[model samples]
Target: MEEHCLFYLAALAIFILMLVMTFFISSLLQTPPRRHKTASLPLPPGLQPLSVLGTFFALFRRSEFDVEPLLRRLHSRHGPVVSFRLLSFPRPPIFVSDRVLAHRALVGRGATFADRPSAIDPGLIISSNRHNVTGAPYGPVWRALRRNLATKVLHPSQLRVYSPARRQVLDVLLKDLETKSSGGAAAVVVMESFRFAVFSLLAFMCFGERLDDEKIRRIASLQRELLSNFVSFSVFAVYPKITKLLFRSRWKKLLDFRSKQEETYVPLIDARRNLLLRRQRSEDGFVYSYVDSLVDLEIPEDGGRKLKDGEIVSLCSEFLSAGTDTTATALQWIMANLVKRPDIQTKLYEEIERVVEKDAVVREEDLQWMPYLKAVVLEGLRRHPPGHFVLPHTVTEEVEFEGYRIPKGAVVTFSVAEIGWDGAVWTEPMEFRPERFLEGGEGEGVDITGVQEIRMMPFGVGRRICPAMGLALLHLEYFVANLVKEFEWMPAADGEEIDLTEKVEFTVVMKTPLKARIVPRKRT
Candidate 1:
């Protein structure tokens, strides 16, 4: 009787504890926004103070309202720069739409403004903050990874080396489009088709081997799944102590999704490790790809000198996420926009036709003489910058700005989309004008090489800018040149109106995928 009573008591105690934790989590996730800490004052005039719930609901509605349009409205109400909550974090990001502040945040400020904030919910964990190059804290590790990426994968010389794969992927894409067009499938969502093309190019670059079409598609799907979940509330939920206990199911899904992603990545990684053992380093020569470079990379970890398999997998996930979607989505948006405006499409088509003629293959080197080709891509990036905010930056040091004190670990972010479309910088901010980048305009002084004063940073900027930018552009230029040369893309049987509504999944993409009718322009 005594034992039974004690057991019941302990069980009841645990039940009460769990009940309290669940309630705590629910309330924590439901934290009021205005109660959150924000920089005092500097609140742009006439802006209503946003509560935690208001900020959450506002951004939560973006999938419906779209990021750009929603931000535009917010900018109007809050003026250029304003404070808003992200996820459920008490301290929301200060979205800087003011170009001056944006420039200062991205390029002007030193590491003080660029580092990841410790208080930001998901970012405190070493894994969320450190595992990969992009998430790596703004420090030595970031530099090492950036150096490796710049030298090995994104160097101009390295880009020159992969020209063959670019040509091959374009050829495969055109062949697939030709077959699809002939099959009377109405139209292929050439945007996704473009993604497949970019994927093939990047996968080959990353894995150093050709993946079968089905395998590539499977990988793309997994990547999209991983990306969709990455920056979501699940990660942030894990940070809040109360929600951490309550949202166990959602958190488990994030882990499961991550594990599922690893399911796709591990096989490729293992295969490459095996390839490294059997394959000879030939002088004639077997080109070392990104995976090969990573294989050779050695990073110090807890007294061991080599990167662990898990770390390598994580880094590869970052690589796949950064390189694939940015390139593929940019290509999709560009193609869709061009289809909408036939005049631009016609000029682009004529330019490619002028050079490539009947040959469906457009080489990377071939893009050199076509300034219009470069402009079209520039316009694409400018018009539809992939990420609206360049991954929330954190201040690592106490800094003073605009008569306000910014303490250490404040989450800072610049409105990347807003800056490019700012009326002060470019005329007709909303217009898709490739002409802005012609011979001696904004793009003339622009460095296609990346890593300079980022005029249009779809790839981001500073020490943490994407290492795959060069390869992404090569993929874009090579494939876009070929695809346009092959097909005069038009809207589906529905007519010229292509749905441009944006959806933020992996990257900002057409909510309705670009399904277009392809009238073959080049001789099959």
Candidate 2:
């Protein structure tokens, strides 16, 4: 799912050949580094290195498609802390999954570990660079960008102000569902529908302009096409140079796409800029959305010039992307689990019914009274994180953990999905038990912040956590509350079993589109 290998293997192979040539040309011209004293760490004697490269050969042996299994193998063999070399690139990065080590990498020794390595999406580097919060490395600039997002865009007040837009989109989604259900059986590719809903809401919220279904779908499709380019799980962000060679054709296409995407963004960016200029002059009562906030503020760090159009556009791109696919994919996964468990769905519906009378559509105003609805949503995030792996964090210095050495510049990643399913961490890890989130259960309203211990980091943790998380959760809660309250969902006629196989792109997605019958709730 991550690497749609069949679609672009030939192109990737050619790129690999090209990259191999490049590597040789560069290696021959550049002088090799002089040998140094063996870097040793205080470690338990039992641990032994299989080779000078530690885990390199085995990792290199596996193809790009083998990443997950490769990670699993290293985790199993090396016990959470593993080291390997990037064949094409010069970095000898390590991967860690131990909770403590991961926390150390992300938070405890934060600054030393914060800079995100540049990946192949030159668009990401050239367009976004450090100006955009999402791709910027950790420092004064990164903090400034993130601080801006928090204060100007992601603040609670901002979320509350945009509540109407979210609820309106949820309303639209429900109405669409009603139309679809009116037909005999709804072959709800809930994934696509969910993506559309999230993107539509994000596009509206970010730009303050509601796009039609076709327009929103085209943007969503382009985002998807771009996301599918690398396909190699987590490689694009961590070991992109090597991954770039593997996905060479895609790299070129991404280059072209970056230019086109920037072009497409120009009109929207200009419209928002013009509107903001007008709103600021008029003192409109309506508070600015993210794009508006971006346009109004000067990037103090960047020569005190007004934010560049390309930079502002990149910020908006992050708003659309971070807000859309991840949340929508999570919504689909939640629905899949909810659809599979009729009892859970019934309990959720009953709770909503008690909170808001039958024939009453669930509204944001009514959410505070419906605890079960909140629990169901949390359970969904824990059960099926859209991004199974959070974007990778590279280590800045050598560190020792659990009697093992984590050399400097290792690429560290946390398994958000694995944490949710760790039996030791979550009881009945595989079961779709929303009750786990109920008042007295093991997962009783656990703070989703992931600060203390990683109960679940579905939206990620520490500095690298998704900035749009609160908005995403709000979107999920409101949408799920309405959809479940309005319909008693059932499996399609062909079979009773609810298949939940994954077909990943940017986010892990359901392979078999969730097709089901939605009998309307009893009218008043």
Worst 10-residue lDDT window for candidate 2 reads: 43-52
What tens-digit string does per-residue lDDT give for candidate 1 at 1-524?
99978975675456446645655697767754342243463433323445444443454354454455656788787676656444333344566677566556666675667686543444323144466777777766666666777898889987777777777777787788878877445677776677677777778778877788899888888777766655554334322554545445756766676677667778887777777788765645466778777777765555436566666777776776677778888888988887898899899888877887575466666788788988989889888988777777877755665544454666767777876777776778788989988866666767533344545667667655666766677777877787787678887775558888888776777889887788776365
Candidate 1 residue pairs in backbone clash: 25-242, 33-51, 33-52
In angstroms, how far off is 283's CA in candidate 1? 7.1
Q: Write the per-residue lDDT of candidate 2 for residues 75-141, one digit (tens) a residue.
A: 7876776655445454455666665556665667666667676554554544476577767767766
User: Each model's TM-score?
Assistant: 0.82, 0.84
Question: Where in model 2 is the C-alpha error above 4 Å?
Answer: 1-38, 42-64, 88-90, 121-126, 230-252, 279-287, 300-302
Supply the TM-score for candidate 1: 0.82
What's the distance in Å from true for residue 309, model 1? Answer: 0.4
Over the full model, what C-alpha lDDT does candidate 1 score relative to the true structure?
Answer: 0.69
